[model samples]
Target: MGRIGVVTFPGSLDDRDAARAVRLAGGEPVRLWHGDDDLAGVDAVVLPGGFSYGDYLRAGAISRFAPLMGSVIDGARAGLPVLGICNGFQILCEAHLLAGAMVKNTDLTFLCRDQRLRVENTNTAWTCAFSPGAEITVPLKNQDGQFIADEATLDELEAEGRVVFRYLGNPNGSRHDIAGITNARGNVVGLMPHPEHAVEDGFGPGTDGLGLFTSALSGLLETA
Candidate 1:
């Protein structure tokens, strides 16, 4: 089975859920610490959600420079699969692994709800099980959820089909309704939704989020 690494940073709220999701998806779960310098040879890495570092200096700004981020940066640049959820997404952005930035919710309040999302791209390493334009329900909880980029970058992302997910109701005021996106090579993906919370049968929003892990496994197998 593929070994998946889930990083745990100070204040991370979803590391356990992410690991459980990986195990449920048939992957070996490897716990990784933020201060560690290595990835423990995990096949993929997941940056789970929550207010890392207590959201100081912006949601992801501090965690982006965590000790372990160096290895993650190297692995992602070498095309290893990486998925970041919510606060993790912010770290990816802060680390410059992906483009754009996130800000306060348009409503200026913490938003939590069962959100509808359309899978816009399923060819990425983390989303191959979803069909293009497929709709799925997942939980969204965050104080800062808006995704923003300059016009040129936005155009590039749109033109290249890098936008992987779109919100159905524009809940957090993301640009072009984008809820998630993949890097240029599709190996790195970041999203605001809590796929980890939706991975099990009885807990969370239901197993609607299982496809993310399955998709990663499929993509990895295909390339292997």
Candidate 2:
């Protein structure tokens, strides 16, 4: 089975959930600490949601400088599959692994709810299990979830088919209703929704988000 690393920072609240999701998808979940520079040779990595460092300096500003993040940035550039959920997405942007910046919600409040999303591009490693244009539901929670970028960047993302997931309801006012996006190589993905929280039925929303993990595992197996 593939081994997926879940990085836990001081204030990470969803690392366990992400690990559980990986296990549910038939992969081994390896716990990694933020202070540790090693990734233990995991095939993939997940930066789960939560208030890292108490959300102290901006949302992801502090955690982006964590010791392990350097390795993550290098690995992601080399095509190691990486998924960033919620605050993880923020860190990815701050780390320059992804484009755009996350700001406060238009409503200026921390929002939490089951969000509807459409799989816009399934070619990414983290979304290949989903079909293009497929609609799914996942739990979303965060204060700084609004995605912002320049017009050219938005146009480029659209033209390049890099917009992996789009919000069906435009909850947090992301540009072009984007909910998730992947790097040009399709190995790194970041999104503001909590797929880890929706991996099991009877707990949160439906199991629609499980495809994120399963798809990554399939990608790993294909290359293996």
Candidate 3:
């Protein structure tokens, strides 16, 4: 089984859930620390949601410079799969591993609910198990959950089919309803929804979120 690492920033709140999700998906879960530079030889890494640094300099702004992120950025660029959920998505953007930025919601209120999302692209490492056009429900929560980018960037993302997930109801006023996106290599991905929060049935929306972890394992096997 593949070993997946879940990084824990000081204020991270969902690292354990992400690790458990990885384990449930039949992969070994490795815990990584923000202050460490080593990746612990994990096949993939997950940046789970939380208010890192208490959202002081923006949701993910400060956490972007954590010691571990340097290795993460380099690893991701070298074809290591990286999945960022909610605040983790924000940090990816802040680190320039992913494009765009996340800002306050349109309503200026923290949102918490089960959200419906459509899989727009399934070629990504984190989304390969999902069929294109498949609709899945996952829990989403955050104050700065709105995804924004320049028009050219948005157009490029659309043109390249990098927009991996789209909101069914356009919840946070993100451009083109983008809930998730993949890098050009299709290895690194970031999304505003909290997939880790919905991995177990009867505890979350459903098992829709499990596909993300399962997909990672499948991708590793295919590449191996």
Candidate 4:
């Protein structure tokens, strides 16, 4: 089984959930610390949700500089598959691993709900198990969940098919209804929804999120 690393930042609340999701998907979950410089030879990595660095100066501004992020950024550049959720999404943007920035909801209030999302791009490593245009419901809870980017960048993303997920109801006032996106190489992805929370049946929204972890495992197997 692939050894997927689930990174835990000081304020991270979903790392264990991510690990459990990986395990459910038949991958070995490896715990990775935010302060560590090594990736522990894991095949893939996950940055789970939470108020990293207490959302201090910015939602993910501080956590971007965490020692582990340096390695994460480097690995992502080299084609490592990385999935960042919620606060993790902010960190990826702050680290420049993915485009766009996450700001407070347009309502300027925290939101917690089961969100409907369209799978726009199934070509990404983390989304391959999903069919294009599939709509999945997952839990989304965050204060800074609004995704914003300049028009040109947004157009570029649309043109390149980098927009991986779109909100069905246009929740959180995210620009273009974007709920998730992938890097140019499609190896790195970031999204506001907590896939980890939706991985198990009888819990969360449903088992819709398990496809993400399974997709990653499939990708790793293909490369192996």
Instruction: Write down the RMSD of all candidates, one decimal each.
Output: 0.9, 0.7, 0.7, 0.6
Best by lDDT: 4
Worst 10 residues of 3 by lDDT: 194-203
The CA lDDT at 79 in model 2 is 91
lDDT of 2 by residue, 1-224 (tens): 99999999989999999999999999999999999999999999999999999988798999999999999999999999999999899999999999999999999999999999999989999998998789999999999999999999999999999999999989888899988898899999999999998898899998998999999999999999
How are the candidates ranked when ordered by lDDT, highest leading? Answer: 4, 2, 3, 1
Looking at model 1, residue 20 earns an lDDT score of 93
Query: Candidate 2 regions off by >4 Å?
Result: none
Per-residue lDDT of 15-52 in model 4, one digit per residue for the tens? Answer: 88999999999999999999999999999999999998
Better of 1 and 4 by lDDT: 4
Clashes of each: 0, 0, 0, 0
Model 1: residue 218 alpha-carbon error in angstroms? 2.1
- TM-score per candidate: 0.98, 0.99, 0.98, 0.99
List where candidate 1 sits over 4 angstroms from the true fold: none
User: Model 4: residues >4 Å from true position, as ranges?
Assistant: none
Off by over 4 Å in 3: none
lDDT measured at residue 27 in model 2 versus the true structure, 0 to 100: 97
lDDT of 1 at 80: 95
CA error at residue 125 for candidate 4, angstroms: 0.6
Q: Candidate 4: what lDDT?
A: 0.95
Tens-digit lDDT track of model 3 for 5-60: 99999899999999999998999999999999999999999999999999997889
lDDT of 1 by residue, 47-92 (tens): 9999999999899999999999999999999999999999999999
TM for candidate 2 is 0.99
